[model samples]
Target: MIPHLWNDLEGTFFPESALDYMPEDRLREVQLQRLKAVTALAYDRVPLFRERMTAKGAKPADVRRLEDVRRLPFMVKNDLRDTYPYGLFAVPMSEVVRLHASSGTTGKPIVVGYTAQDMDVWKQAIMRSLYSAGFRRADVVQNMYGYGLFTGGLGLHGGLEGIGATVIPISGGNSERQIMVMKDFGVTAVCSTPSYFIHLIEVAQKMGLDFKRDLKVRRGVFGAEPWTDHMRQYIEAASGIKAYDIYGLSEIIGPGVGNECEYQDGPHIFEDHFLVEIVDPATLEPVPDGQEGELVITTLSKQAMPVIRYRTRDITAIDIRPCRCGRTIRRIRRISRRSDDMFIIRGVNVFPTQIETALLKTEASLPHYQIVLTRKSGLDQMEVRVEVTGDMLRDSVGEMEQLQKRFARSIEQITGLHTTVTLVQPGSIPRSAGKAKRLLDTRNEA
Candidate 1:
């Protein structure tokens, strides 16, 4: 179900090699035209944008080019929260067909309403992502990401259907059932969080299932959590499938925002649908191309709920040049860290994902660990409590000490911060149904 509107503009506004050969000035012109149309819509329809523009003593017409977007006020998550339920909705209730809400970890769930056309746009983006990942009509897609209010499962399902693939909507959990379905139905592809995929591999081994020989899966799209190249190699080695990294958030759209192709260089952003900008987190000014900073997005062609200059705390860089796969759309590097999630440990910025990468490379039997941050004697400290598995226990006391020292040194190398490594029994850390929250900051308690 490709959008008819997209097809109409395919050769004119969006060319196959636009990013590759299109001059920057020409691309900017197209973006400016779209920005003007969206701004006009915001001024005439959405009260939130109208009030925001008015408060700035600016009118929608004042935004005539891409540069003018900087003058427009930035939209933050708090704005959506203040509006609540549907206050920020641009279209009337009658036109809306679906509503999706954020996980609400920060506060109230930010609700977004979508019309039929908006849903089509979402499907098209997801389909584009899947196609970029090498999925085809005959492939059997096993969706392991959770379904429902969370966007992973349903969003990918829509895409698989769009691509004419046999979609097995096996939402997360029930690893045994997932394996059974895969074996019985000959599923060819799978999608889920990287952690869950690792867990499933462990379960498969325990049940005497050979991942490479038994499963028909040829590719796996892993996202919803940050992963490193080392983790990608591990997943590929375990599942006998080419692993691709996908990037998205419910705030803008679902998992189809960007995806890595067979080249596995980086996840290409669907720039024709969504415009991405990398800005200095503190100044909100655009950084030079390829510089790491916060990612800001604007929905260029959305009708139901168009988000403009929405700040995504995720930190990454953008490459506007053509990819090795010959796609002209800009590609975004895997997110290095989220600005909101960065912990200040003794004046150093620490990202939990980096620590996780370090841990995975340690080859320690510890698959589960928790990072607890506390202040003692007016100083900050990080305690990494890791559960020792059978592999680590096979070593003697001296080997265990060496493992601990090695981990501490690795942590220092990656995060540039000293960490206290505590070995614990397996199954000690709390489990989570959704994304795991590994960090516990008790600094306020001090």
Candidate 2:
């Protein structure tokens, strides 16, 4: 059986690498070997890893199997912040081939280095992610996920090149031109944040561009933020392409940690290079199978800065079951929200995504919405401001009022909070080409 409905894509998917097809037992063996080697590297070269491991009563030799990774110390973003630029590099500056840093918008940027081999692994992982999303040599991929200091741009550039696709390093912004390139250049695929793609839909509509008739893109790889199925449907319908979710963090190997295959079941976590664990964010212990918790990852193949059980703070559940794509790697539930993003209002935990999911479900409401949290009269108030579609606008006032009441009920149903849903005119909500800002709490803004 071959996937040939879309032209001669006889082999759009790369041959399963040993990492992709290795048996579970053999994969575990490789993980153990790499884990032991990295543990030795971090313990011997980096004082921080050695001190932490020594304090935890574990030595490199003590970690004999993949299960032993739990005994080793956990690495947090603060560890990277504490080390600053190169404190955790296993190799010297001369051996390090590249450097990529986080935005550090909150505070100190977490820096990561890559040796030549580390870079090679990164390229391979990205290729795996692309292959799963149906990327092939014949496809021309537009790398729009930012470049420089941030790993999304260059990492994806190298990845598309590795997969033998024609790479377009257009970067971000210039929404109209991006759509123009897609129309004129015969661009076949795209990778960017889901929110940005939705914005592109708006841009295309404004340009009077018809995606199905005017675009050649067959599939899209969307990542960098948590998007609901409502968002996916909106993007797919607007772009006329099957949408796939990609998951990664700068601390890990970037956007290739996992991706959705054509099956689109879940993003396959590349367990061969990165060992993933779902754990209670508060307790720092592994969670039950198929349970939702924080995502923790340990870099088994990284040389410059191998992370051991680094707490990702990303909330997701490991499916434990294999994917329908036939890849043995375990899959992770789409990222719901980060633990830090979880805010309890009136004893009910709520994430901005919850509101987005609820609003997107309503046909009359546009995907653009904002959750404004404020303290008024000594009580926390949650108000969801959403845009109404043009059809809803053209309708009578009674119709709009009923839709608004429906949206309010849906929000209350999802977040267990009595809420206010304000319907706004289209284009009123700000659209971001990067990560969409969804939450604003006036109580904490001071």
Candidate 3:
């Protein structure tokens, strides 16, 4: 890795990007200034924000310092849905140049809007993200993130172009064509979910294309779903590409809220434009740095739809220690699970990521797996159906039984809940072009 690429924050060529390297005192000064402005904007324009603040007996004027951010009303996912199409918008529809919404599989999709200035800030954030990961203007990036209402595709697309990188706008799916494009176009970088990238690795192997020898891909920017460090290691080892974890949400300006630098230690949050806080999901109280909690963000620079103390629901901690990369921006622990994604099995809180950690540790099976939750005799049960590698599938029946037992033991050790491990043949588990669906809860089924 070229550590010298973006080092020397003082000598940094780009002046607009210098906020990342400012001193902590100066960073907080800027954050406080933006915080006051955004809160006032939301309070004056967005009725929902204003109503919540009023109910709490707090006004924009209550924000005296950074700590006073707690005085502002908190915004949750339901707020966006309750507001529906445009209730939370701080500006009129005419000023909104773009609109993006969540999948809303549960109910009404949470819609978010971006003005022209908002679009510019989003692009700059992405450009900073890519630069932190060692991406330069000469890199060829294949953006496999899905486009349209989903912000992943177009978000990265615009930013990659903003940095002057040649982009292959191949929105998710079409794995075969994706591989072909990488081979023929001399693609050096790729942007997609970590799960989708694993699928690409499998496709390339089937087509007899080696990543290290055949593809010029040296770096991968992966996000859109929670993934573990084990998964990151697996991706890098299997594909021979450095994998960087990026963090963001649809309500918080898409995927450029924070990103991993070349060190891959943690993703640095862009403090100048976004104020981040770790709050206890249950108590809603702030947690000290280095302690895990729900991530809350305030869009400091967003003009069209600025959200205040927006609850992200993703669990992580902030690292205030200086990074080896010399950026003053703080980094967040990689998000592997969300509060809403946790499921209780027989009174034991279990996250899908815990199951993934166990499954990946085995190394005898592929990462393609699903958790099936069922209830029998009024007791919760979990059945892990994981796909075995071709070599493992060819093993004798006794070996397969041993593998299954090993998986069950590993899961029981970590989660303290015994599970039925069902080893399936290769390709039995469904693959996804976007976010991989890892959980299939049938306990509620009649």
- By lDDT, the best candidate is 3
Q: Which ranges of candidate 2 are over 4 A from the true structure? A: 1-8, 12-18, 364-366
Displacement of the residue 5 alpha carbon in candidate 1, Å = 22
**Cα lDDT tens digits for candidate 3, 1-446:** 12244643344455445667888898899999999999889888988888788899998898889999988878899989888999989898999999999989889998999999999999999988888887777889999999899999999999899878899998999999999999999999999999999888988988988888999999989999999888888889888899998888999999999999889988999999889999999899999989999999999999989988999999999987889887888999899999988999999999999998898777633458899999998889999998876656644888889888989998999999999999887788876789888888999999
Q: Regarding TM-score, does 1 or 3 come out ahead?
A: 3
Residue 147, candidate 3: alpha-carbon lDDT: 85
* Between candidates 1 and 2, the lDDT winner: 2
Candidate 2 Cα RMSD (Å): 2.4
The per-prediction tally of clashing pairs is 0, 0, 0
- Which regions of candidate 3 deviate over 4 angstroms? 1-12, 364-366
Error of 3 at 168 (Å): 0.5
**Candidate 1 to native Cα RMSD, angstroms:** 4.5
lDDT of 3: 0.88
Of 2 and 3, the candidate ranking higher by TM-score: 3
Model 1 residue 382 distance off true place after TM-score fit, in angstroms: 0.7
Clashing pairs in 1: none
TM-score for each predicted model, relative to the true structure: 0.91, 0.95, 0.96
